[model samples]
Target chain A: MTDPQRIWTAAAVIIGDEILSGRTHDKNIAQIATWLQVQGIRLTEVRVIADDMDAIAEAVNTLRAKHDYLFTTGGIGPTHDDITVDAVAAALGIEVIIHPEARAMLEDYYETRGGLNEGRLRMARVPAGSDLIPNRYTGAPGIRLGNLFLMAGVPHITAGMLDGLTGELEGGAPLLSEVIGSWVPESEVAILLRDVEQAHEGCQIGSYPFFREGRSGANFVIRSTDPDVLQSCVDTLCEGLGELGWDFTPGGI
Target chain B: MTDPQRIWTAAAVIIGDEILSGRTHDKNIAQIATWLQVQGIRLTEVRVIADDMDAIAEAVNTLRAKHDYLFTTGGIGPTHDDITVDAVAAALGIEVIIHPEARAMLEDYYETRGGLNEGRLRMARVPAGSDLIPNRYTGAPGIRLGNLFLMAGVPHITAGMLDGLTGELEGGAPLLSEVIGSWVPESEVAILLRDVEQAHEGCQIGSYPFFREGRSGANFVIRSTDPDVLQSCVDTLCEGLGELGWDFTPGGI
Candidate 1:
């Protein structure tokens, strides 16, 4: 039987030297994770490797073997460092060639601006048996091979490509979450929290310990699919905290 | 022969339900990466696992085996959901009991507030043979076991602990990077860029493709330990970009 809310796992491979050098703070991993969570697809791991062919290929194969889907970002451009397609082909034991559609896009991109340069032709080289992922941001398209969606590293371009393909893919129902805010410290209310968690077998509870000035506190979020069960737990929690003169509000689903 | 600058490969194991659920975006990885880079330590991998005991234990054992140093964040709070200490003990095949030092800190934290609750006592549990990592933010001290640095998930607190320990750890010299920026499209300036890279054997060069208005461009950064080599490469890059009629600038160190 097929589960509608099936949690599919993904391994995101971020290829770039900039991220490693701390020149670029990566925005893709968090963006992708948020998108996947809404679809009930779990981003299991994220690997940020350099533009080296060996490193990219090694991480590609390793991630592909462990995950249901492998999403790679970066190294698909008109330059020497843009070797993602070549590296992916090497990892998949396939040939690298320009697809008819990609060639057309490349020709159109260059012709629209006058003529094609030899360097511009390099962006058309894609892994064999791959489908073109439309890039609305720029003319250089993304590629999809099996479960791997090879995207551009630039945040806007990557976002555009992902948005374009969202409607075509099979995804899970979005997971819902609920949270309760409080000003009670974790240390002051530890046992009551533990008992609440043990009593609610269906929900997953988390404590976020925070501090304002010298005063310490926590925000406890109880998560579950059943809204009724979640509310009941929250009610009990509020009562427990109220008795101790602790500040808390309705939270979690 | 021992290298003058010790570069220990480190893996960060982030244990939290909030991070996994997409409720919180991680600030620790970037902060830690910056800290380690400055200290000459390399962060090779990062794994964000849930608060499940099995998952935490598995990640701890796996990471500790591969990397020279393993830094874990989250699940060290006083709450029952905070299972890092016990999980680390289970992973290392050791016992977890109330460490005298941890207990003393807890006693002080509670005694200052009149008297201690049983829930507060849970914070004292530590894996056998591990030394305490003094926390300057709050009294709840972190622990260190061999290469493993158990730390708080809170950004400010985690940074404080890492900062305190930085002077003691051996590290490589901070990597230097020189960014040569240009507004020309990547395709237009690919050949000369490749020539510049081929000429600079000592430096590592990268292209950061970006788009402004309707035109696309790239920022080429040359990185190396040798200042002369880096400057030479930067000069070649500026000359190349200048030939393309793109505005060039020396961005950073």
Candidate 2:
């Protein structure tokens, strides 16, 4: 009873006070979303929350139940504010246990740099019945419990962890997209855009407007799982824009 | 009697499919978070959801009820995908209507650029009984209804809207922060960080680790509502790092 057409969706919880405090501009949401798209999964939602344990647990529980997979970035570092592990454990109602393999990895990683202290040892802890996601860049590995992935706050570290988990998750057909840009204001051709989208089934068109060099313009992105449908929609959209007396670029502006 | 020491909090919902699909990197979260911090309103949480109506409504209702103010960005353009007005109306159990002032403003703005068409007029639509937040950069105005604010997705336009509403909201004591950087492994001094944070009654220390130029370093940011407490916490953290034989920078790396 497997539905091949079912869309696999995922959600992300970005945990950090620095982000909520406006000190750090988040890079993980884009990084993870792009990576997930390559794996044929759609990122449906993202929540950027503080380091509070209750908020983390609430976001984890809510998003995990609604999506096939839930990913969290941040709060895995060896510091006082690093509370993601404890919060995720509490969310799953599981005990936190130190993984022996992770402990050994940290021991080996810090062998030349520094010895494993109490704070460094804390990174080895994971929720009960969880597995480790390899982090080639750092000593401590990412945590994977059921459908929840606990990734590092650092962008490069999260990239390495995601690289290890690539091709491991089950996904549906990858969503394909084509972009067309025009210098004309979007409102001038809005009705035509709507008509073309209505005529095309299985394709969704997103219009993003911008003002540059004292000129109004917009980039229309057409997305569909089926290549033929996406192509047809793009063609019709381009034809419609042409008829409306607007020149459009093949790719986005 | 109202408590003078009460901390005001706000939450933001970034409503866009572009952001969720990683087609566009989000800028509103940080912009709004920084603005709110300066206004003495703590930005507690942020949710980036798709442009779907139900999703928009749900996020709006959930966050609006929990915080003193809730702001939403995106989905307020002339395209069919711009449905924030309708979705917020549904969330508030109200109707969407064309604001006369907004419509007049648009008419005047488009008179020179182009005549107002059906699509252009769509920007004037707002939730019932909502006030307008002026957008000097654009024709359409941002919507403000009760504790909810609907802003533009474009960074500069949103900046214009935020500028219009600056100092209009009730706020409390602005949070003060100081940063200190050190070229040392955070794990080596983790215990000291925890103890220093514990001793500082009203201060929070956030340790952000980085590796650059073949060296590991961390920037510790301490925040407090009281300026005196913030300075004291920074002094204590610096003392602790100095005692550990680490050369620390007064400002962050």
Winning candidate number (TM-score): 2
Which regions in candidate 2 have their CA more than 4 angstroms from the true location?
Answer: none
Clashing pairs in 1: A178-A252, A178-A253, A179-A251, A179-A252, A180-A251
Residue A34 displacement in candidate 1 (angstroms): 1.6
How far does residue A161 in candidate 2 sit from its true spot (Å)?
0.8
List, residue by residue over B1-253, the lDDT tens digit for candidate 1: 6575555677788788677666777888778778877777777767777788898898889879987888999988888899999999998999998889888887886777745677677778889898888888777888999889999999899988998888777666556678876667778888887889889885777878777776665788887767788888899888777776778767832
What CAPRI grade goes to candidate 2?
high
lDDT of 2 by residue, A180-245 (tens): 999989888888888888988988999999999999999999999999999999999999898888
lDDT of 2 by residue, B1-253 (tens): 5576899999999999899889899999999999999899999999999989999999998999899999999988898888999999998899999999999999999999878999999999999999999999879999999989999999999999999999999998888999999998889889999999999888999999999999999999999988888888999888888888999998899
- Candidate 1: list runs displaced more than 4 Å: A113-115, A251-253, B5-7, B113-115, B213-215
Q: RMSD of each candidate?
A: 2.8, 0.9
True contacts kept of each: 0.46, 0.76
